[model samples]
Target: MSESDSPDDIGTSPDSLDLSPREPSARQRRQRRPWLAMIVLLLVVAAGGVVLTKFLTSAIDYYCNVDEIGAKEGCEAGRRLRIQGIVDVGSVTDNATATEFSMSFGGVSLPVVYEGEPGGIFKECIPVVVHGILRDGVFNGDRIEVKHSNEYEAENPDRIVGETDKGSECSQ
Candidate 1:
């Protein structure tokens, strides 16, 4: 066939075709719109999830140093809370039924009461985190998580030295 005989061969050649100027059809545009909408929806959902997670975590987590708990208002009575402090000297009172202790962080001291058997590391001067609620004027603790400071004893090289054994010498 002659080079200019057919209209279908206007932008095409036998060896190479130049079909770069074609406009997209209506069906192609419609198909792309849904995909774009889906991407926007996914981004919105992810952002909402992040905000919800932050709100939930903040509502559940609570931390208060011993002094902060005492000086602040509305701290003496509340829901479950966490208090961090060092055990006061001669403040641990253990009996057959329960263990009562007091801790000092900064200038404040708060009493902690635990009903279960105290751990081996439960002693005066050790750092601890008490978990419970404050009812009336006292902290009614259900669980205590003791965290002893790192200490090394030269006399006892075989045994690990912990703050619980040191006995109430920690400074506020």
Candidate 2:
């Protein structure tokens, strides 16, 4: 066989068949890994921020009997809440504009300023749930719920004798 035509190839070696070069070096791969980790961390932080915002924005409304509002702790002012009590009959003072009124709760006798129209159940001697926030040593109510015991008698057959009858009577 001629030297140039030899089957034991010369230029056609396995090393010459490598077309794809410039494969990423270990250093380059290591550098890219940090960026990938940073991206994952950023995504996690963003997700946590969203969850925290939702939790903070979720209004926490709670019911407190008359005595709780006048406690030493003062019912944690600035949080939305409902204070249940008897509407102080004569204690309700209608503002000159008639759009606002002030009522008092029994026991603590804390004065609550209410804005907006009062409901039909807003009468005196009724169990009331005032919705608002306790701020500056007073209850600023935006909505009021007057719950009567008789209203629940038909719905709850096993009604107690004095379940809704609890609370103070307004002092005229």
Candidate 3:
């Protein structure tokens, strides 16, 4: 048969073809369900956020100061807490199993017994955050996080560490 008589050769020109828009297939409709996809994504994200908040809250320990300890209930019942205070000078005693010291804030003092290794920053008058439980008028600290302020030299070379001297060369 001639090439023109073949079915494959039918309507080869652009004008002879049916070019109108066609309805989408089932597969295409399912793939393009934006509302369903968005709802699923939102549910997953909300569940993840709720789980993260619960985990973080359970892991955190609340912090308070020495002066607040007297007014805080459940302190002496061995409840785990984070207490911030300054180490009292000449109050540290190093022992075999533990290091005992007194930390004071606002004239309120509390004894602390730490059995863990105190870091190099542990010194008299240094601020620290102790994580442990309070019992029998003493805080049994299992962990210590030292809080050190930033060290910056003022413009004046002869003045105190952070003090500014008007006549010093730093003003220039």
lDDT of residue 98 for candidate 1: 81
What's model 1's overall lDDT?
0.73
Each model's lDDT: 0.73, 0.66, 0.77
Per-residue alpha-carbon lDDT of model 2 for 71-160, expressed as tens digits? 625365576767887766456667754333344454466677787668765776667788888777678888888776744434677776
TM-score on alpha carbons, each prediction = 0.52, 0.45, 0.54
lDDT of 1 by residue, 25-60 (tens): 999889889888999999999998998897786544
Which parts of model 3 have CA positions greater than 4 angstroms off?
Answer: 1-61, 73-77, 150-172
Report the C-alpha displacement of residue 73, candidate 1, in angstroms. Answer: 9.2
Q: Tell me, by lDDT, which candidate is best.
A: 3
> Clash pairs of candidate 1?
none
Model 3 alpha-carbon miss at residue 58, Å: 6.7
Query: Over 4 Å off in model 2, which ranges?
Result: 1-62, 70-75, 96-106, 151-172
Could you report the Cα RMSD, in angstroms, for every candidate shown? 8.9, 10.5, 9.7
Instruction: Score residue 118 of candidate 3 by CA lDDT.
Output: 92
